[model samples]
Target: MTIWEMLAVFAAGIGAGTINTIVGSGTLITFPVLLATGLPPVTATVSNALGLIPGSVSGAIGYRAELAGQRPRVLRLAVAAAIGGLCGAVLLTVLPPTAFETIVPVLVALALVLVVLQPRITRAVQRRRDRDGRTATPGDRGGPLLFAGLLLASVYGGYFTAAQGIVYLSLMGILLDDTLQRLNAAKNVLAAVVNSVAALFFVFAAHFDWTAVALIAVGSTIGGQLGARIGRRLPPQVLRVLIVVIGSAAILQLLTR
Candidate 1:
């Protein structure tokens, strides 16, 4: 790649790392930039996945305070994420690209709607619980439904990796009675797991550009730290709005591309 193209990819990586840390659609930024730099779709995808690992880890580490006391929950959900990520990675090798092309946008759109309605949904469910003389405790682990939904989202994350964060946040927000910041912290860890698993699979199954990987890795690592600072400071309402806006952009880009 030319110097300018290289710089663009690096910049995109920073943007993606920041956004991914904040809202989970960082792939939308890095993928197109990689494409513009002349990498093939699969190559770009593989390289991007490989490169973003540091950013994901960094983001997760940045949220370490919020992760306190959630070890059992994160671990349980992680097992499902790992299984689903492996399946999605395998599908990437066998399935045609078009298999997820149409469905992906639909999934993202649905996730956005879920995010928007999550507050109301949570309230309604709480009311039902109240009527039944029941209450949610901190020990609640979101049950089997959340597990299933997270598994599915992880599969998608492993496959395409665009806006899987939004889907995760939506599911957790509605099902888990916790602050959004905590959920966002979980989302980062889950995203990291999916990306790491898929990237490992791609190492044996796919081609990649080392230059692209290096650029993104370094840039995203830097952005991850920056994102943590910005994201943690945002109020819950602002954070939700940010997720919605970025998710919408992800949808539009997916549809147009």
Candidate 2:
């Protein structure tokens, strides 16, 4: 890669890390940049998953204060995430490259819809809970439905990442009684687990570009810190709009390519 190309990938990494920390879908930024750099689709996906590990962990650490008193809930959900992530990682390796290429745009489109609808979904869930006379406590682990939804999301995260965080946040918002920041903190932890597990699987089963990994890791690590600082303060609508614009761009690129 040229120096310029390397810089672009690094910058994308930073954007992805920050966005992932804020609302998820960092892959929409990094994946397209990696593709533009001429990396193959599967290689880009594997490398992106491996590279974002540090950033995910950093984001979680930055949210340590919000994570307080959420240990049991986080750990319980983590088991489901780990299991589903492993399954998704296996699916990636078992399928041919063409399958990944064909499915990615569809997945990205679905992710964008979820991102766009997240606010409405939250409000609807809240209303339903109120109507049903159901209340969520901080200690609530979100029951079986939440567990099942998270498992599916983790599977998708393991496969392609992208807006995995948004899926997580939406599910938690509906099922758990917690502040957005606290749910975001938990999202980071789940993302970290899914990425780490999938990356580990790729290490033994798939091809990787170590240069891409290194560049993204360093850049995302820095972005993670930046995200934590601004995420809470940033308006939700702004983040949603940003994600929609970038995600739409990614979808267009994938289809046009």
Q: What is the TM-score of each candidate against the true structure?
A: 0.97, 0.86
List per-candidate RMSD values in Å. Answer: 1.0, 2.6
lDDT of each residue in 85-183, candidate 2, tens digit only: 998899888887566557667766776677677677767877888999987678789899999999988988898886778778767866787777788
Candidate 1: tens digits of C-alpha lDDT, residues 168-231? 9999999998889999998899989999999999999988999999999999998898899999
Q: In model 1, what lDDT does residue 234 have? A: 96
Q: Which candidate is the best by TM-score?
A: 1
Query: Whole-model lDDT, candidate 2?
Result: 0.86
The lDDT values for all models are 0.91, 0.86
Query: For all candidates, what are the clash counts?
Result: 0, 0
- Judged by whole-model lDDT over C-alpha atoms, candidate 1 comes out at 0.91
